[model samples]
Target chain A: MKMVRVIVSFLAMFFVNAVSAGVDDTVWKNELKTQFFADRSISETENIIAIEAPYRAEDAALVPIRITSKINQTNDKYIKKITLIVDKNPTPFAAEFNFTPLSGKADVAMRLRINSYSYVRAIAEMNDGQLIMAKKFVKASGGCSAPIGADLDAAMKRLGRMKFKLSGTAQSNEPNLAQLLISHPNITGMQMDQVTRFIRPAYYVEEVKVTFDGQPVLTAKTDIAISADPNFRFYFVPQSSGDLRAEVSDTDGNTFSQTYRVEP
Target chain B: MKCIWIVSLGLCLGLFAVQCQAKTKETLEVQKIAPGLYFHFGHHELPNRDNHGAIANIGFVVGKECVAVLDSGGNPQQGLLLKNTIEKITDVPICYVINSHVHPDHIFGNRSFKGRGVQFIGHKNLARAMQARGGFYLQRSEEQLGVKLAPKDIVLPDIEVTDSLTLDLGHRLLTVTAHGSAHTDNDLSVLDKNSQTLWLSDLLFVEHLPVIDGSLKGWLRELKALSALKVRRVVPGHGPVMGDWPAALKPQEDYLTMLLKEVRSMIRQGKFIEQAIAEVGQMATGRWALFDAFHKKNITLVFAELEWED
Candidate 1:
């Protein structure tokens, strides 16, 4: 009877230890909850906001993420803010994009960082008191340790030369997709300088504003999760022929702007 | 029973260790990039304390009286070995030697073909870069590989192409076009007309993560243009011969496009440099294993170039 009791206890202890050895789900959950509410409150509710990205990215530092909103039912409504939070990053809040009605649709396609295998959350707020959320888990790592290609001096030479590629012709009623390619290291603080052991100071794009024919269309405010050399692809309803302008500024007092002429 | 179990475990562990060691060693696989063009596929294995020579892919085009050699291997010894291999396949002598780019692994064996009267060719920019960095490259290579490489032994390109040039090997015509700034400021592609073979140097890397010291957009554009060519075979700078030119260009093009799109968005958002690096974390996934080593560096270069104003 004593031997049987000992075996039972041993088996029970083994099971308990195995469960404890697993990843701390509560830790990640707490991190997500804390980061989502760091600046604003959020509640998980169903709405038209959706985020598209691979569940497992091949490259961790430059994962493609797309956020789209199907809330076209109302004309006056606009997305006030869109936030992407990668739960496992040292700083979970990846990016926050602010938009105005000129933004045609509450849509954005950008790349972001993933520190590890973690869940990514996209929270969108409408003009009215409505919060819509979408979540996805991605498996990726080592984004913080990759090296920047150019030397510091070389990288700063031509910092903000923008190229805009309009996907569709102006005649086509289909919403034109504009792809803006920008140049910036968007260095995250977690990376160590190759020559120096000291961690690099955090430098990333803080805000992006896109204007169509001098009218405000889209604006974005982001954090460390924004990948280097930011690329923005979004759609805008082309009313007529005009110039599309984008002005971008980083935290380091560097401002770059470019204008592309749109034709009918 | 215990002894037998121990022996079985030992054998299993031995097999596992051997498999692990084998995996670590790179496999050099050669494939036909075009009908008659071929290139070896493998990363340059940096020599250890015992190994004396480095490895690189040497490409050639067979002709009636002679063959055209593109980029020699790491050392004179490697160069001789490659020359012998070429000689065995063709009875003609190697008449023209072209250095695809100015990296040492691709140019170090220039001395081996020195006395053979091989006409050396390269981009105008390569000669300048080589001249400027020849001494430094030799010194570092000798120190790293524990072998002496004199700058005098390095052969400069006797023939320099600025815009475009052609080499008519009688039976096969090879058009050499200098594409504007890719992989490096001076990148050249050798297109064989008869076989529709395109020796793309380091322009396209298959499976391996591409190293970009040049313009990301430019390289992508170059690849796109190359894909449109009548290329039936493609010999890359470091990998196996790509049978499918368009399919081969997709991975490289996709990678660059992804990098450009991602980095451009970050710059637009006003993400600082540090944040950009952090946020762009290992962004791509699958098939390509060394994506981590090359992606970040590519991002940095792309960011710098894209942000640069005229």
Candidate 2:
């Protein structure tokens, strides 16, 4: 009986180690919870939102992540905001996205720079002020490629260029997918200049506001973790023929705006 | 009789140790592709702990007055092996070490040739790329390549080639040309005037799947410029050297062109990147080695670039 007990304990320990192989989840768990929602309880379940990410990213510089809401965006009960977090990144807080009733759906997709293998979490704050969370483990890519933008020159040459891609035509009072493309080299300040031997300062998009017919749809505050040439896909509902406008600003105080007509 | 037998055994052991040392110091194997031009072909495999990143074609050109090392090696030790090979072949001193591009596999061996009177040459943008990527490369070399690299391993070029530069190695003259963004932002190709041999490093891959770390459109455009060149034979960064001038470039061109076309059409269909990555390259498999390793990343990069097209 003693020998069997020892074997069982050994197997239990091995399983525990295997489960917690990557960076400690508790670091981000405690730190982010304390920082983002101090004195407030957070529900650690996929009841409100769920995040989708590759189990192993092929490119560390551009890992695609999407967040889907289980409930619809209604005035009475809706997801008001969602905060994305990477546990092992230099900055655990990646971005915070805010939505209004004008947003037909709370689904969003974007690319991020993951520095190391860690848990990616999305915390949703509902209209009732309840905070719900979803998390996924991701293994960061390892190779010759660095977690930085490729073709910085091309991104710089077309800086502040913006375009709107709408899926099919807009429908009245229903969810329609729209993508916004912005050209900006989100320099993370980690790279050193060979000749100058100096670290470049971090310059990235600080704010993004999207509106339809002057009604607010989505607003996001992001940091350097956002990939260069930021591309965002979201859903917005148009009542009739109107205009969709996107206004973006960076840390350097540069603001760019573009407007596209939506014919229902 | 017993004492003599013991003595002979010790002698035999000493000889074995000496033989081991000599074997370790054996020079890297190289083939003389042309008169005064030597080439070393690297195997098509991903950089791993077993290889230590020594997976790029590296060689040298011997001239009357001096020798020019085209690329060093994948690591400091590989660089040392290459230096030993050069010493065994000729007595001329090495004058210039020309780097092809910024990939770690191509430039990591630079530390082996760091000495006075041996000037390093590269594209004008090479230093900037090295500076931007050197720290990250140094940090991850240990975990990825199983070799810990210091800041010294990331050497910058002393001389930059903006448009074109010519170096005289006595009877041999090498014309170094800097290309626009193709394989990478900084790509330099060397042409030997006397032999008409062009060393088109990663810019042309004969067998290995060509990696696209730069613009897909830019690479297609650079292919046009490279195909128009007139040369007796060309050296690729990977695979065998070919005497067929522009004809040797067809495989890489076709691969890049197919990728561009599929990605553009996917964008036209309003497909997302994930959908395109899954459905785009089904037909092009088994054509190139390391396709599974690098194709998805290539599709992702090309999709990101072409989606913004007007």
Best by lDDT: 2
lDDT of 1 at A149: 26
- lDDT, candidate 1, at B26: 28
Q: Model 2, residue A188: what's the lDDT?
A: 81
| Residue A103 error, candidate 2, Å | 0.8
Model 2, A67: alpha-carbon shift in Å? 1.1
Residue A66 alpha-carbon offset, candidate 2, angstroms: 1.2
Q: What shift in Å separates residue B235 of candidate 1 from its native position after superposition?
A: 1.6
True contacts kept of 2: 0.43
What is model 2's DockQ versus the real complex? 0.35
Model 1 over residues A3-74: C-alpha lDDT tens digits? 996686566556544543333446446666664555455666656788877665544656778888886523
- Taken over the whole model, the C-alpha lDDT of each candidate is 0.67, 0.87
Residue B296's lDDT within candidate 2 is 78
Model 2 stretches with alpha carbons more than 4 Å out? A1-24, A193-199, B1-15
Give candidate 1's whole-model lDDT: 0.67
- What is the CAPRI rating of model 2's predicted complex? acceptable
